[model samples]
Target: MKTDRIMWGIVLLFIGGVLLLENFNIIEFYWGRVWRFWPIFLIIGGVNILFTKNKSQIAGIISIAILVITLGILFYKGQQPRQKEVTISSHTEESNDLDIPRDVTYSHPYTDSASVKTILNISGGGTSFDLKGSTDSLIIADVQRKLGNFSLETNKTDSITSVSFKMKGKSKWNMGEGGNDVDLKLNANPIWEVHMNMGAGEVDFDLSGFKVREFNFDGGAAALNIKFGDLLPITDVNIKTGVADVKINVPVASGCRIKTKTGLSSKDFTGFTKLEEGLYESPNYKTAVKKIFVNLDGGLSNFEVKRY
Candidate 1:
């Protein structure tokens, strides 16, 4: 067989095997760590080009062996836990504009006047953001960082309160040293609409105690884990991602529906019945009083929805 065809077959086999293992939960692969080694592809391509002109059997064997060895290394690394000591250095000249890093705590007092509806907007990248508990205050945020500037602003218009928390500048991420970490808590008194835009990082949010009407996330190359509660009659979640691992959990008692527009992505929806292409619903969807609707749009991602 031609070396080119052999190389293509090997690539396909590797990809298919990894996807199968990941979908079945037999192995957990971290794409984030593997992505950093993208230069391996370039090396493989250069070797193939150099040997293609020589049609000798030895040339083909050498090319195939190199491809297999490189893929093996990638497979092994992908299965390993992400190293906390990994550091991401920024090469952009704009890095000098970043502010001195500091640790800060912010709180916004809750008042009855703006309890009707609350909108929370978060924007940042290269950090970990988490929401775990409810707070008596309107919102509380604790930020620990080694770089970048963090700010929070709030405004009230009639009965709706809008809160915006964001990182102001770009900075290098030295995970071995320290990076931006934000822990957040929000009041459960008012109905909430949350929107988050992040370039990359990890997000773990538990909004089970809050009355969430709408939740939206737009991210790239990230790991996202979110659990939603049935505090409201209807909850809508919309997520758009690029190269991500997304896991969502919903209460088993609530009716849930999922609509996905994911291309070349692996999906596993446990305890869900397929109604049609790109649509799934829980068994109690038609009769349950409370319902959740999730919409996923992603590219090259792993998506899972589990009823808990």
Candidate 2:
């Protein structure tokens, strides 16, 4: 057999076997742990190039052995527990030193009438953001930061309110250092439209109690989980991501249509039927009163939509 063919076969088999084991719950692999070792691919390519002129059996065997050993190391490291970073808590003591990190709380009053429409804009990176429960105020944000600063601003126009929450400066990563964390709560009265831009981090939002009109997210190398309710006549969701894991939950009774433009990505739309290329629809799409439209565009990511 050709040496190139042998190398390609081994690569495919390793990837297939790892995915199979992950699907069967035999081993949990953390891709983040393996991401830093991406330079190994460059080394492998160099090795193959060096041996290209020599088509001897010994050269092929050496290449295969190196590949196997590199893969073995990655497999072992992926299953190991990640080291925990030191995190700052809200109750941490205050210090006179300016270098000490501190917790901050921010809120915007719910002064607008219930009939008003509200838009929330969020932008940040290297942080964990969560939205859950309802608050009497328009919005409440509690931030715990080890570096950088956060800002919240609100503006109201005729029949509409806009709230913006964002990190002010870039965050620098240090070894064994903690990251910023933000917890957010929103009022349930106003019809909401949420837009978020995240460079990298984790996001968990439960908008099941609010009347959400539209939701949008743009992120890179992040994990996102969102659950939506059937409180509105129609809900629109749009997401664009790169190298991320995204999961969305929708009500089973609500009709849903999904359209995706994904390149080198995996999708699991379990309860939806394919209507056409890049289009899927729930079974009750035609008859259901409440409907949801979802559009997803991603590169090298995993997308899953489940009914709850």
Candidate 3:
């Protein structure tokens, strides 16, 4: 019995130290994803409590149990080292009598929406309806709330026309958009053309796995990324910005004509090549057998055009 007491005492001491470290911020804890393995610790401690007649032994066992369980949870979450992940805090609710809706089958133009107007926010999320095989809809999203982790996702298999989505914010997201506007980030796992306006956001768009055609980019105090290697049967492309960094990726087959402009600042085309010549520049220009054109403009910060 005495030996058992000493054994439990050592376990208790170790657990106590772990608790202290946690309190001092030496380790972080996450109660979000992993709470499944917890019962094992409690069960062990409980079993020890039922068999151990000595008070000290039971106490030690319980303390050690708690410590092991706590640390296991912290370590399994990948948050132990402290890294930032893109996460959003948003709500989706259905409300009828919403603004309005119109369908466009031809080139008539149409629109759709999802908004919670009473939430005291200048922020909202919704999808722009598209024609299964053609482009006909124009998007106009006006959100005016302080935002963090804003994202827009469009269906990958559908066809659409002229997407003019915009975001405005009142903060600095390492990406900029003065204040009072929507912020945009797009990642579509399908093939489609995109025209986006990120008022102030850290916008990263990836088409590396799909096809793309006619893309336009506009940023206001933000970062922009458009990879052309992901686009197929390319038709045209353009990029414009107010204040931020821009990165464009194209393929060598992209014989597309491109134009770039910058604000009261210097431009960076270290990403692009063969500027002294024209579209039919040379065999090295890698013209995209298909007819295509690309135009680019930027204001303040860095701009780039490189092959993906």
Candidate 4:
């Protein structure tokens, strides 16, 4: 506890200094000035109590209160600025290189191949492919022939097609850190599949508003989170973890079934729907899983089936 308190003290002192510096011309990122001060309030008071003596009184308490109230207002006001809803239809063809289905609009696909997919001996820092605001396009990430960091993220206006990815991992000893962070938008509702493997590193994903056939997770030791974006529901999901935190979110009316060995039961997972044996419960259930399969592997945090 004492060690933790010292660490907190150091962190707060750093934040306060940064904020104080930013308040003047020392910094200029518009967000930096107003945003940096928040850490001071959050940490100082909490650390003061641990530091004892005159620590918890006067300026410390005042700073915490200011931080708390400022945060409350900032959040409340931030959410109030809702964008006007514009009608978006993907039914018509916007271009030849892309597919815009009746209920969706998409972007072009990627075509990269390798004879040895998994063992891509990367000698540089890392290669990156970022997908943004193509909410109706299906993305196929084939890591079955990939080596190196595979990082992917999508905002509220991105989507994928076919809903499947081909994934694979090298032999156990060859795996390393740094996988992918797939950010799902609150308004993303396209059906897609993901297949990727990680040697190491935390994989953070958001499933605020999404629909999919299933998820495939394999290998690695890390905590995973499957959380909702606000209050959202997703269906047709599957996951298997070696050793990590496993979470699942089930919405009312969406069909959910989890098939796993008893090993996944020990970790903390909320709202789990256990399936009975290898049973394919329905034509609906069978079709859902077949429609799209997203596979993920190895990350320190958040292995999720999302709703965005």
* Residues 111-218 of candidate 2: C-alpha lDDT, one tens digit per residue: 777889999999877667889689999999987675567789988888889899988666421111245667899999999999998776668899999999999999
Tens digits of lDDT, candidate 4, 114-220: 11111111111111112222233234232211232222333331222232222223222222122222222212443433343432222334443444333444434
lDDT of 3 at 133: 27
Model 1: ten consecutive residues of lowest lDDT? 170-179
Per-residue lDDT over 42-140 for candidate 1, one digit per residue giving the tens place of the 0 to 100 score: 788889989999989999999999999989988998888754432234433234533334457788999864348999999877677889598889999
Candidate achieving higher TM-score, 1 or 4: 1
Q: What is the lDDT of candidate 1?
A: 0.81
Model 1 regions lying over 4 Å from their true place: 1-16, 31-102, 171-179
Instruction: Choose the strongest candidate by lDDT.
Output: 1
TM-score of each: 0.77, 0.77, 0.41, 0.33
> How far is 140's C-alpha from truth in model 1 (Å)?
2.2
Off by over 4 Å in 2: 1-24, 27-101, 171-177
**Candidate 3, run of 10 with poorest lDDT:** 114-123
Best to worst by lDDT, what's the order?
A: 1, 2, 3, 4
**Pairs in clash, predicted candidate 2:** none
lDDT of 3 at 40: 46
